[model samples]
Target: MTQPDNTDDALIRLFNVSKRFGAKLALSNITMDIHKGEWLYVTGPSGAGKSTLLKLFYLGEKTTSGQVLVFGTNMNRLARREIPFLRRRFGIIFQDFKLIAHRNVFENVALVLEARGEPRAMIAKRTRNILRHAGMEMRMNAMPTTLSGGEQQRVAVARAIAGQPEVILADEPTGSLDPKSAEIIIGLLSAYHKRGATVLVATHDTELLARREGRIIRLEEGRLVSSEPAVGEAP
Candidate 1:
């Protein structure tokens, strides 16, 4: 299949990518080129390895056998020390929200910038701005546990974007939100895509796909069954 003509016409490329847990074979020869500045949905039934695929892109997991390239470097051949450097291009969100209970929202977002050795002034400015964009500035000093589920998830989203990564991976971000909250989060992500970032949303939300601007690929039992263009196709 032809890949999208996006910002980095030669961005993330996966060729015959597969992963296995012993003989379980979690993914099998999944190949695709994810261009820059495109929004794609990695849709699949349970146990289809969608999560595993996302993990590989973020360096959280490695492929068992395949050539995985990000930017221009081959991941499997890279050194352990290189992994952290490679992941700077990505922002990730999970269903669990992964917030530290003891940390307030500002601290949660600040943690990312701090890890990268960003200056205090930069961290404060960026964290505050990102929280405002995420609509959580007022809750900046509130603990994650003190906020509602939706609010906590927004903080996670804010932390991810505070760095302005080249790629954003959202693993079931809207799974437990009310319709209004889901739209708010989803719309924010859509806006990011519009501003030119590679986005892969691992989800089963057909409703969102119905309004997609990129493409959808479905995985079944670790095998890619089909690929389709988004609804409008911009024709």
Candidate 2:
């Protein structure tokens, strides 16, 4: 499918992007644009390269060929010292909820702001507010191991948004949650997107696609198969 045409509004652009792990090709010739304030769903079956595509955005995995441009900067040419600064512009949520094991829920979220050198008072206030929104305030002092999968993921979501990042990249965020928890997670993401943050969700959950309206891009065997609006959605 032809991709979006408004280059002026594009926050991320991929041109002939491809990734290979030894003999295994993870992504191939991915050329597209992710516009600012857009909510995009990346859907595919297992081993279809959904996660790898998201990784390229945050620099988790380097592409073997082609370029990934974020905020007008080419990721392939980014300097080592510049990576952390570039990553601060993004909020990434992993399926496993990569919270610090020793840090409590509040600390886990607070650390993001702290790393950015935010003032102590502001960090405390924002952390509390974000956790409250995620329904994790009550468990502020609880460690990752103490919280259920749903609770941990909630904390992960809270941490991701604490910095008010311009973009959010979530990989299988609701894959292991219960139906209600999944709904809650999606709701939180949708709320963030409504606030003008770009959101890219990698998921294979049909129920999730049904619950939300957005542009959907499907991948198969490392290649983009389709890019279109959801059924009943206005293009």
In terms of lDDT, the best-performing candidate is 2
Clashes of each: 0, 0
Per-residue lDDT of 98-143 in model 2, one digit per residue for the tens? 9999989999999999999999999999999999999999999998
Prediction RMSDs, each to the true structure: 2.2, 1.5
Whole-model lDDT values for every prediction: 0.85, 0.92
TM-score of 1: 0.94
Q: What TM-score goes with each of the models? A: 0.94, 0.96
Please write out the lDDT profile of model 1 over residues 25-111, one tens digit for every residue: 999988787766778899998889999988988678889998788887888888998877777778888888999888999999999
Error of model 2, residue 164, in angstroms: 0.2
How many angstroms is residue 61 displaced in model 1 relative to the true structure, after the best TM-score fit? 1.0
Candidate 2 regions exceeding 4 Å error are 1-6, 230-235
